[model samples]
Target: MLSSYLTLAAILFCIGLYGTLAKRNAIIVLLSLELMLNAVNLNLIAFSKYGAIPSLTGQLFSIFTITVAAAEAAIAVAILIALFRARGTVLVDAFNRMRR
Candidate 1:
């Protein structure tokens, strides 16, 4: 059961990695980042449940990670919105040159 959870997380992380690297849209990149973070959370929960010295530490860490990821997403969305207003595009490549 733990192995299955790990395998699923690995697959999710890999897909997220590919999306982050290969996608051009800023929104898609942000979603991909969220996916990767979720994979890490899965691992944390799995270990917390299955480890020899099973405890709540991993779950607590996962909660903290989720909180941080939420903040990151909010800030990132605000920045993306501002950038879109200024540049009229959300392509990752378009954000390379931020100066006029």
Candidate 2:
């Protein structure tokens, strides 16, 4: 069961990686990042439940990760909005070629 959980998490993370790499839209990339983060949280929580620890360290770490992820998302969204305003498109290639 633990193995299965870990496998699922790995699959989710991989899917997120592909999404992040294959998508050109800023919002889609952001969503993929969130998906990857959730995969990590799942692994942490699962380890916390199954592993022999004096305290719920994995759970605590997962909480910390979640907090950090929220901050990252906020910053990323702001940057995306700025990019959209300046470049008129969120596609990675468009942003890359942008110049005066």
Candidate 3:
């Protein structure tokens, strides 16, 4: 069961990584990043459930990770919105310049 969970997480992480690296849209990239984070959370939960001397530490860490991911998404979206307003585009490649 743990192996299955780990396999699934690995697949998700790979897909997320590909999206992050291959997509041109900033939104897609952000979504991919979230997916990757979720995979990490899954692995943590799986290990917590299956590891010797199973404990809640992994779950606690997963919760913390989720909180951080939420904050990151909110801030990233805000920044992307501002950038779109200024640059009229959300392409990751077009964001090379930090300032006009």
Candidate 4:
């Protein structure tokens, strides 16, 4: 069962990695990052449940990660919105120039 959870997390992480690397849109990239964070949380919970000396450490860490992820997503979205307003586009490639 632990192995299964790990496998699922790994698959999710891979999908998220692919999305982050291959997607052209900033919004997709942010979503992919969130997916990856979720994978980490899944792994943490699985380990905490299956470990010999089970404790609340893994869950606590996961909560911390979730909070950080939420804050990061908020900031990233704000920046994306600002960029879209200034540049009229949200494609990652369009951000390369860095100059109006």
lDDT of 2 by residue, 1-100 (tens): 6688889999999999999999988899999999999999999998888766635898899999999999999999999999889988889768766473
**Model 2 — which ten-residue stretch has the worst lDDT?**
91-100
Q: Which lDDT value does model 3 have at 6?
A: 97
Pick out the ten consecutive residues of candidate 1 with the lowest summed lDDT.
Answer: 91-100
Alpha-carbon TM-score of each model against the true structure: 0.94, 0.92, 0.94, 0.94
Clashes of 4: 0
Candidate 1 lDDT over 4-88, as tens digits, reads: 9999999999999999999999999999999999999999999999977789999999999999999999999999999999999
Model 2 clash number: 0
Q: What value does the lDDT take at residue 26 in candidate 4?
A: 99
The global Cα lDDT (0 to 1) of model 3 is 0.97
What ranges in model 3 sit over 4 Å off?
A: 98-100
- lDDT at 84, model 4: 98
Q: Please, what is the whole-model Cα lDDT of each candidate in the order they appear?
A: 0.97, 0.90, 0.97, 0.96
The clash tally of candidate 3 reads: 0
With a 3 Å backbone cut-off (N, CA, C), the pairs that clash in candidate 3 are none
Clashes of 1: 0
| Winner on lDDT (2 vs 3) | 3
